[model samples]
Target: MSDIRPGGPVFAPEEVETPPKEVSKSSKPASLWTDAWRDLRRRPIFIASCCIIAVLVVMAIWPSLFSSIDPFNARTCELATARQLPSAGHPFGRDNLGCDLYARTIYGAANSLVIGISTSVFAAIIGGLLGLIAGFFGGATDTVASRITEIFFAIPSILGALLIGSTFRGSGLGIWLVVISLTLLGWPMTFRIMRAAVITAKSQDFVIAARALGAGSARIMFRHLLPNALAPVIVVATINLGGFIAAEAALSYLGVGVQPPEISWGLMIADAQRRFLEAPLPLIFPAVFLSVTVLAFIMLGDAVRDALDPKLR
Candidate 1:
């Protein structure tokens, strides 16, 4: 179809009925968490990690669910029963102490998982709050927060844990003391991540609009900024969960963590170290469990990180 005339008004080029641009189902606006959850669902690693984590959670909650044998049962110490290799009845074999290695290994997960989750929650809350305040206010607030974070960062996480753990070793607050030590040093990394996220988020249009609407600082921070800033902190916390677990184990191995009668994988490792050649089952079982648990948390964190990051998409 030709226009009316080049010299004349030229009828609009036959108003091309460009079909209204079809709106994609995916184009509907969604919150960051909504998009992240959708992305997370599609990731195999996320699914696997979630499943493993769920199982670990169950194991942590109820060790009895996995085994009928009592962890407190003393070994017969008979030449046949003592340090027996893996058998149908005792898959993880008997330790030198005559305790069933399998039972101890399963029970150990409870302590490690509890400490990991507890420390992560404590760190995230403390760090995230400080970060929100610093990032939103900037200036002197930020300087103070950043300086404190730097001070903590300058101290190695493990060394700080060791020192604190050593100080409180004989107090009998074994697990709690270890958790406290980890929390003391753990918050800085989470704070740094959250601060960066908040800084980036605060400058966005929504925050500006919230400010324009005269929303109070607390309201804006809690309602608007916190949701956005929390994503990165969550990722950091998840990854650090594994680190905390490992740290607990390391401290336990060094004889400063969970004390006697409160079995931990690290304690099991320490107990088995003397007789590793004579009976490796005690050492191997706990080490394997610890490794799997740590790896699961790390994998979960990595998957979450990838899912949340727009650049990864």
Candidate 2:
């Protein structure tokens, strides 16, 4: 092709001018939480789990919103309606004691969640601190702390709870007993996680830089190491929260957890287990609630774990 503008002085290719290429701007990389949240927003599993958890949380916080029946009131129990199946007025039907099974299930959510969450918090704090201290120091302190952790880890949670419950025979141990047992048994896992994380983080360039900058040990540990070391702990705690709830149910069923007067899914199952042949709804309703709740948490934890770990993502 020729530049046809009649024979005006045609410019050679070498003399022609061209536009310059545009330079691209660089942006800062997203932080861990930002990236995790972005990934979580796009995943249907995360969304579904979060929605399920939100409804359960609301039910736990305000049972009246979902169910008008008061399970706590002894007067509400009708001998005539005992062991009844799902009906028009009562969707979940009546328990062995004739109390509305739906109402009791609703109320039980709060207790189970409390036990699980509180135990997780307590265990994480206690274990995380000990781990931080041991990992940061990495000497005799590490050896002693590690030995202690190992000792505690050796004791199975259920067995320990049973031992403690038997020691107090006849004297009822309330919610606190279960909380204490779970916390005691659960911390070792958190301790191991935090300790490993801190060990890895303490040797990183950021930690060395902080130390070189004259930051104190306490400052370096809490301000630097702890934050970096929290990812694994958070993941473990989220999963453990669900385990604790299931454990609480198991313990209560075995007569070692929250006793009479306190309502829990485990206790409900225990109550209905004896006569489950006569009426299965009482056992099934609470069992279903517990299973669904545990599943939701586990799902949430798995989603979080995948988001946090780039390899998994």
Candidate 3:
């Protein structure tokens, strides 16, 4: 078409000018973690689980904030008030030993949180490191590590914990005994996951490029492979934290974990089991709290897993 105007010079087809093209600046693409965070924000399950965990963490840290009674003090108990139902003062009532059930439940949060968090952290560290080294190096190192992991993996976690707890009974190891037991049994699963992740990630283009660029073994393994491999490990760890809490409770209930002078949900349940026929409040309260806490963690893990895995989304 011609650019024709009454008072302007007519331009030839070759002389006609076209407007410059506008270059739109594209925004950076969202990363996997960024997408997951955005997804989690919209999930009701994630929000609810987080709230429950926050409250439980606070209860673990400051039991006195929730309950005024001295839960740890057995001296304050009176057999006259033993096995009483929930009253105005004690929402969960008194245990068989006349100890405040509410206060014990509040205090019990600390032990469970401690065991769960500590075991998860220790297990992840040991397993992640071993898996990284084995997967990155691959050969005899991988063979030996896999062999060791298989040996441990072959044993059921709860059974191993039961055997360890039973064997070390009366050794005065205290809560650390449970922590150690769980950590030892828990690492194999984490190791296997991390090793598989590393094996997959190391073969990716980015890692091969990094290796070609002369990155060191440690650098390639941690700087490149670890971040990619960590998502599944984190999901597993979150779920295992809940499982560890339940395992501790079972061990405690069986009289092989968290002895007297150190109150845990399991210990309280064990004490209450004898008097359950007369007053179920003692067993009911602690058991309910334990169940809720475990359920919350498991829910949180499921939400996180769903958010993090693109396939699930």
TM-score of each: 0.89, 0.90, 0.91
Where model 2 places Cα greater than 4 Å from the true spot, the runs are 1-28, 168-173
Better model by lDDT, 1 or 3? 3
Query: Over 4 Å off in model 1, which ranges?
Result: 1-28, 73-80
Model 1 lDDT tens row, 1-313 = 5556667655555566777887888676787788889999998988898898899889888989998777855543334576878888788888887767787888888999989899999999999999999999999999999999999999988888989999878887869999999999999988888889999999999999999999999999999999988888989999999989999889888878888889888888888899889877778889988998899999999989998899998
Q: Supply candidate 3's per-residue lDDT for 149.
A: 97
For TM-score, the strongest prediction is 3
lDDT of 1 at 259: 83
lDDT of 2 by residue, 1-313 (tens): 5575887666566666788977667756788888999999998988998999999899999999999888889998999989988899899999888898999999999999999899989999999999999988999999999999999988988999778765674665578778888898889999889999999888899989998999999999989998888888888998998999999999989988877788999999999999999999899989999999999989998999999999998
Q: Which lDDT tens digits does candidate 3 get at residues 15-42?
A: 6689998776786689989999999999
Clashes counted in candidate 1 amount to: 0
**TM-score of model 1 vs. true structure:** 0.89
